[model samples]
Target: MCKITSELNDLRRPSLLVDAANCGTEAYQRRRDLRRMLRVAIPPTARAALEKLLPIEADLEKRRRMGATTYSFARHVDILVALLAEARAFRAS
Candidate 1:
């Protein structure tokens, strides 16, 4: 799977794993494969949200070309930490 797909999988796993109906678990069972989410339902908000990754990907690619080792391992925990912080602020408003 591509890095984008893998990362999206990580982002999706928690809620998606629990929502069998949303994921079309039965329909894609035989065709179970990477990015299977594409074969079934992709949440209405998902497209716009995922489009944000393109810029992030481009930034990371620039870092890659510049030989930045740390960029290769952007930990999800760190991302989640930042996301939670933003989420908290969003909730406050």
Candidate 2:
């Protein structure tokens, strides 16, 4: 879990992207994969939060493809990180 968080932190670095389109792509994919794992690992009670976050993350990716600004990409990363934190907490509980 700490390794996942570290990967996310690396993805958050602005220097990772040469352009906005790819800024969140890798992180988005990683997050999606994590979401899949989390859905099963986390308790059923926390599934509602996962459901709410999924579409938001998808939209953020869409925005990125649509040429969202670097700041928007950064914000997207922030939201993913928060979602991961929420999932981690749910798993820990």
Identify the leading candidate in terms of TM-score.
2
Superposed Cα deviation of residue 32, candidate 1 (Å): 22
- Residue lDDT tens for model 1, 14-93: 34223532334333222232123234443233333244433444455466457777664333222233223323333444
lDDT of each: 0.37, 0.52
Off by over 4 Å in 2: 1-45, 69-71, 90-93
**Candidate 1 backbone clash number:** 0
For candidate 2, lDDT tens digit of each residue in 1-93?
554345434443233432443443345443454456345443334345555555666677677777866437555665566456555555666
Model 2 worst lDDT window (10 residues): 12-21
Candidate 1: residue 69 Cα off by (Å): 5.1
**RMSD, every candidate, angstroms:** 15.9, 10.8
Pairs clashing within candidate 1: none
